[model samples]
Target: MVAPPKPIPAPPPVKRAAALVAILGGALLLLWPAVLNGYPVIFSDTGAFISQTVVPLMIWDKPWIYGPFAWVFHQHVSLWFTIIAHALIVSHMVWLLGRVVGWGSPRRHVALCLALAALTALPWSVSIVMPDVLTPVAILGTALLAWGWPALSRAERAWLLVLTPIAVASHLSNLPVIFAVLVLALLLRAGWGVVMRAAVPLVGAIALLLVTNVVGHGRLSISPYGSTFLLARMIADGPAQRTIAALCPERGWYLCAFVGRLPDDADEFLWNQTSAMNRRPDGTAIFLGGREIAPEAREIVMETLRREPGTVVMLGLGNFLTQMTRSGLGDTTRRRDVGYGVIPHLRNGFPAAEEARFQSALQQRDELNAWALAVARVFPLVLILAAPFALLGWARAHAARDARALGLLLALLVGMTGNALAVGALSGPHPRYQARIAWFLPLAAVVFWRPRPGVIPAAAVPDPARSHTSPG
Candidate 1:
């Protein structure tokens, strides 16, 4: 009764080879900074992750996923493999984005990757051996799952379904970022089919974390030490200090012993070995002792909220606003002196040969310090100036009926805001906290600037009224 449907043609071998070359080149581009440094970048938290992998023990604060991830790639041999994995994974995601936006050509993919490497903090995140790189990947993956599903090939869809959950499970903060994006999609009426499809990774991530925790610690929780972080945030922001001062004589909390002398910074309160929580009056250091008072910390946080709700809200809002504008590279790129920051952890986790290479790295020698500091000063200013223009571009894309671009823009906006709120409002605002994900802003801008017209696959463009059917 009808003619047979036409099958989609495949790329020729020459084009396929070219595309493969571009992906490989893009992966190398992502790793250029680390190559420049002569060693993979390390952060203060890098050692914690390394210890978790080498010793194969769980830390109270961070999730156990990244440690095993590192181990799987590195095989306890060298950290370079882990960083290389970061590059390859991100490059593949970039290529996937290109396909969704009707620019799946090798040349375009290479150009986009080059632009991102040069303009954004993405290279820095990739070079570093931390889970921070996964934040953007998870966010982007969720967007693709929600609105770009129809555009993706079956194999690509399967890859994201597997990769997204792993990315989400890599960090505690990522869970909230993914949830916020999904919620925003629903609020924008992305439809139940879209929301449910996007939510697959979120559910899988949650299940992975719960199952891992239950197996490791006999606890079915996301973060057993979460209360300590909340307490640290409250104390740093002044509400917990006020709460402790008022409730001490009545409640006799453990934190009362050093009421007036507590460090006013959340990081110091949580990680400074010299702080009262970590060091006793006898001067014996109990690094990260906040874990011991976690239950009490929860009580303190609840009481602080009950007593000073307005103050808490105001301070949290202040932190969130500050975090939104504080993206920079210095914190992640600066030199960490021996016996301090990441050095001790590296020394403890790796063999002498590895440590020798690390000691001679550009970061340890302070060779890139000035450049990093300069970037720290300029990058945030650039982002602040670029925000309104980015919004305008997104509006233009929406007006043009470019749902693929619109979906991506929305994902980056929501993910960045969620990251700020989750980290800044609760943990405290740090330049690195925002810098880790700020790359998405510039990446979003590129997508807006370069999208081709009338070339996006019809199936890829979401239908506003079609809420009943799900894309494969």
Candidate 2:
């Protein structure tokens, strides 16, 4: 027999060096602005940092619910920190993707491209500070847990399982996404052993929350005072609703001038009345509480929805869309105000110019939203192009044969799609809501469509002799 062919050499140092440069270059490009800008480290940032640091330092009260953490910390923290955290999280996600797709593969390039696209497509998200930072990290972590399942040893999978709860606990919105990924993993037959291994951490987190709440708050939930406060507000503001109704139906065009500019108490009162009248006879409202609804406020919104389901649906859709497109570097202004200890004073002060500026910013945000919608409408085309190539790469890598990789692909598809639909349907298609899903779409495409190495190109496949030949 011919002398054993020399084993194909590994990638030369030059190639490896180039790959490292590309990866680092991509990461730096994505992160440079945040570093230069001082990273939003106050307000939301401070709040998140506090939640992560202080709450753990204190008793574990309130289960670390997203609500309590936000409520307590939002006031004290800076939006800058939120922005910085988000940037770092996104960078981490990129690094994770590089590892999963094989650092030097074309798929890795695709991941880089997708990550870059996400930065550009949702610049507001990348640059801002909010719970939104958790979006990519959660999505990527879930995907990695699924995709890398087969390749992972038992110990590794167990570690991922433990990490899942932390991922979910980081942001409430991540719950549905994580749940979706877990469900898909089950369907793909990742095996019960793997599933349980992943769930241990989540279970431990919940247990910890329960113990904390009992010790710190004397109740299971964080906002025990919220209901009582809400009731008091309703009592205080009850008459405002009746007044508005009496005035609006009875008053003339003068009402137009005073609609949104009404006093806070008046608005609260009317909102409550509207909510009360719309409740079911049994006294339960359509939507649940905990999202800033006073008793009266709930009644007001319920009444609107009941009276005009169609209108409510339309408006909800509009709001959702608007929310998705709007960006605030996670309450940056609020954080700065607090950081400077001017929040209390500013709240009492009435700056007409600032108000005007705010209104103008709102108008600009709406315009940007319109542009985002136009872009989103054509997003499917991009998916069509990128997905196939990624899939080709996956196939070349025998991705399906590897349970971990396969599971990840399935999880990402299902979780991302489910989240997109859920947000669109329940919340309405806001770009911000979509932003969470949007950021992951390109990565999915890259993971599925990037080309593999060491495989014969399609062009050579039909020629058996040529196919057998190695790349020189």
Candidate 3:
């Protein structure tokens, strides 16, 4: 959806017989590492997802859906199911984007989809076991639905409608990212109908996440560390210290004692595992302790902002800019291990002896790592540089009009910025957080690209909501 699916006319795009082969080739490439491993690749967080799934104990950091989904596979000893399912889901979304713009002959569409796979680290997110991949899914789904809904076929519309919410529901961070996208749409002048349709799933996802958390945790909670993470971000940004200094011995913030000991980076404070937050021996954060500290975290953020408003604003803007260019492949995990991350924590029924047997079967991803590293590093920066031009191009393409192309570009811009704020501004600003949504910049560029020499108005000008149909 980042690309406004414009029409492709001349130079026959797809050859009938070659289409399927091209698509299959891309799918294989997307899942190449998973295939080599003999099982799905695992991340440090993958264990949390597996634990919550099998134990039925709600882990605040993990969403309710992922755990159950992971559990079913773990129970059946079909962990590869996670990687394959993620692959097919993302593959279809990539395919749908190709169809939306009405690209080329059959061969071109296939080639375009394959080309997209190569040009971005989008697929690598799916190849690993983490929720970051879904951020793109929600972004693309909402963009396509809003921009090309009129031209989309019923199946295409339904595909996006179905997948969008699931993607949103997959991770807590996605909620704010998608919400920012919707708000940006309105700011950019997208119609009320467009916003409402997009909101349906966005709203549904929020509700689902809550209910799922209630079911999993037996009590209602949105992510367990919202305020704490925010507090961490404020601290990292260098303002929470003001609040901490003022509230020390008199307040029971627990954190007050270690005020000077805080790390310069938020990730060091929140994720170092040995941070004061991790009181338990089992590697789990002390839940009750976190609860006691959580309320103060919110207060610290607000009070600090009051004490130093300009600093907070500057930090936020810096984070947003940093987010625009920090994407990189394999940023989420250490990027090794077949299923060992999941093995040690397998609810006692599984034995530690089996860990060695499941270690990644084949260990060479030299080619993938090399290519993705470049895509991750260069693509986001290029997109950011090209964003203003892309937006201006969209506007210039019109005669006192702005439509889907601009909407798609704006959505990508806002979504990436918002995600950076949600995930990075608070707690920490990691390249991985930005990487999740960074690659979409290039896709949007391609989707709403400038037309050839004298192509008059660009394809499919903006339209009213009622008049739209998913492209056939």
What are the per-residue Cα lDDT tens digits for candidate 3 across 375-430? 55655456566566656656654533546556666677677778888765554566
Please tell me which predicted candidate would have the highest TM-score against the true structure. 1
- Residues 1-472 of candidate 2 have per-residue lDDT tens digits of 4452231223444544444444444444554433433443223233333443334333221135443433342343433333433444455455445544444343345356445544444444555434555555566666665454443334334444554555565544455566666676677677765575445434544565555556755667533323323332322333333333544644432222344434334224322433432233355563433333344334544444455457545543554455444322222323232243222322233244422332343222333334334445545555556566656655654543755555655566665566554444333344455655554555656555543333321110011122221100
TM-score of 2: 0.53
Model 1 TM-score?
0.90
For residues 1-472, write the lDDT of model 1, one tens digit per residue: 5553232234455655566677778888888888888889888778778888666668878888898887787776678989988987788777767677776667777887887777677888898999989888899898988888767655566778888998999988888889998897788787776889779889999999999888877889888778999999988888899889988867978778887888789988887778877888788877558677888888999998999899999998899999887787746666752235455555666666787878788888888667666545556665766677778768887888776677778888899999998888988888777888897776666666556787564222112123211111
TM-score list, all predictions: 0.90, 0.53, 0.78
**Residue range with the least summed lDDT across 10 consecutive positions in model 3:** 457-466
Point out the worst 10-residue segment of candidate 1 by lDDT.
Answer: 463-472
The candidate with the higher lDDT, 2 or 3, is 3
Off by over 4 Å in 3: 1-25, 36-39, 69-75, 218-221, 280-292, 330-341, 346-357, 361-402, 450-472
Full-model lDDT for every candidate: 0.78, 0.44, 0.62
All-Cα superposition RMSD per candidate? 5.6, 13.0, 6.8
